[model samples]
Target: MSTILVTGGTGTLGRLVTERLRAGGHEVRVLSRHAQPYAVDLRAGGPGLDAAVAGVDTIVHCASAPRGDEQAAAHLVAAARKAGVPHLLYISIVGVDAVPLGYYRSKLAVEKLVGESGLGWTIVRATQFHDLVVRLLDGLSKVPVLLLPAGVSDQPVEVSEVADRLVELAVGAPAGRVEDMGGPEVRTFPSLARAYLRATGKRRPLVGVRLAGKAYRGMRAGGHLTPEHAVGKGTFEEYLARRF
Candidate 1:
């Protein structure tokens, strides 16, 4: 069995990927910021990354931050190339190229770095996760009125399903920039917020506020949606029921 290294192995998606890979009998190495033996920070030039990547056949890169993903990818790519790693798979967001947000731009830049890193690579883009939507609603519910962005819709997928796909890709041959993944249904913020309220039994006045910005406009225009590839099975309601 091949040994695989998983970056961000402790995160929502990466954790599941690591678990699945191990369950499949593949030796898995988890690289994270705080985990021992491989606790290398990817953002700060990734010191001690070489040891974590050494002898690894494939690297599943899921570690990312809002600010320094490009730098992190740069360091990881350099390390992977140095270690002569064969396959490097990345998990990205849908519409990263179309979205004008700073975070999305950073993610797109990382994707470019991964593609041109002179290594066997696969890039898979997924829509927002259900956890993210719940976090948004949870934050919005803090105040008496739930103020959500007007005209913004989301297709949130289950993180576990995404993890499954990533693991399958990691174990297989490199397929560059494969099909995007999305949730089963496209939903609006207010609509999902209603679902949240229903599941959590929280009653509050819901209001939609139209925000002005290129990022917000991009989100409102459905740049982050993948209705054609709506392949995820779990629904937001189902996630909510399980979450709460």
Candidate 2:
């Protein structure tokens, strides 16, 4: 069996990836800050990173934060190069190039670093996860009125579907910048918020406000959506029904 090291193995996507890999009878190592023995913070770059990446066949990089993602990717790349890791697969958002947000820019930078790292690499850009959309609605539901951005739409995919795809890519040979993964449907924020309210049995008025920003404009223009690549099976309504 091949040995696979999953960075951010304890996270939402990483945990699922680790489980799937282990279930397939592969030797899986979970590398996270709290994971014993391989507890290395990628953003800080340490000796533990070198140890974690050594002799692994593939690395499913799912660790990410709002900030410092570029630093984390650089450290991980350096460690992977030193360990002679053959394959490095990264998970990125769909609109990193189109969106003008700071986090999206960081993700795009990481993508470039991986592509030019002189190692066999693959990058999969998927739409936002259903969980993130739920979290956004949750935060906006704190009051009687739910404020959402006008004209902004998202194709939220299932996290498990993304993890499954990542596992498949991890086992296969590196194919740079493969087909994008998108959800089954493109939905507006207000519509999704309504779905959440219906599933949770909460009553709230959704108000869509027009925002002036490049990022908002990008989102409104459907930069974050991939209608042609709607390969994911799960729907947001299904997720809401199951979750609630």
Candidate 3:
């Protein structure tokens, strides 16, 4: 068993990764700002970071900024290098290269950092999580008619599946950039929202609005969904059943 350090242990994805690593009989350490079982902060360069990663053989870097903060990725890569961590696994989003979304741009920058860092690394790009879809549906339900960006498609993967994949990457040898992982099927926002509403027994009408711009055009072209390699098993309907 190897000692693995997870950068975003408190988050939705990080929490699951940490649990999986622990369950696999690996020594797990978490990096976070707040004090917990293990505490370290990449942004502030906390002292605990070095100690937390001292003997760690692998680092699962799940911490990321909201698209606009590209500098954070550079810092994280540098920190991992300085810590002398042998392996670094970064979890990234799909369509980062095809779409010009701010968040995707940041993720792309991070992927570049990991590639150039010369550290043993595996960069796994995945589709939007099922939780993101659930959150969007819940937030849009407050409006009388749910307004969704038309023509945009997404293949949402389960967070648990992504977490499992991250663990697999952590334990394996670094493959600079791995294949994209996506859901079983590609789906549109309005259709997904309606399906989720019907599954949850909520009566909300969905209004599809075609957005005009580069972002909308990119999404309409199915830039976000992976076409070639999709390894996840859960479908949108299964995710809805479990969530609602």
- Which regions of candidate 1 are displaced past 4 Å? none
Residues 1-244 of candidate 3 have per-residue lDDT tens digits of 9999888887999999999999999998888767475565566665566677777899898886564345655666666788787898999988899889777877888888888897898998999998898888889888888888877778898899999999989999888888889887788787788788888888877778878778778888888889677677988899888766
Q: Write the per-residue lDDT of candidate 2 for residues 1-244, one digit (tens) a residue.
A: 8999999999999999999999999999999989988998899998889888989999999999988899999999999999889999999999999989999999999999999999999999999999999998888899999899998889999999999999999999999999999999999888898899999999998898999989999999999899999999999999998999
What does candidate 1's lDDT look like per residue over 1-244, in tens digits? 8999999999988999999999999999999989888999887755489999999989999998878899889999999999999999999999898779999999999999999999999999999999999988889899999998999899999999999999999999999999999999999888899999999999999898989888988898999999999999999999998999
lDDT against the true structure, each candidate: 0.94, 0.94, 0.82
Whose lDDT is higher: candidate 1's or candidate 3's?
1
TM-score of every candidate: 0.98, 0.99, 0.94
Q: What is the lDDT of residue 19 in candidate 1?
A: 96
What is the TM-score (0 to 1) of candidate 2? Answer: 0.99
TM-score, predicted candidate 1 vs. hidden true structure: 0.98
lDDT of 2 at 64: 93
Error of 3 at 15 (Å): 1.0
Selected candidate, larger TM-score, 2 vs 3: 2
Best by lDDT: 2
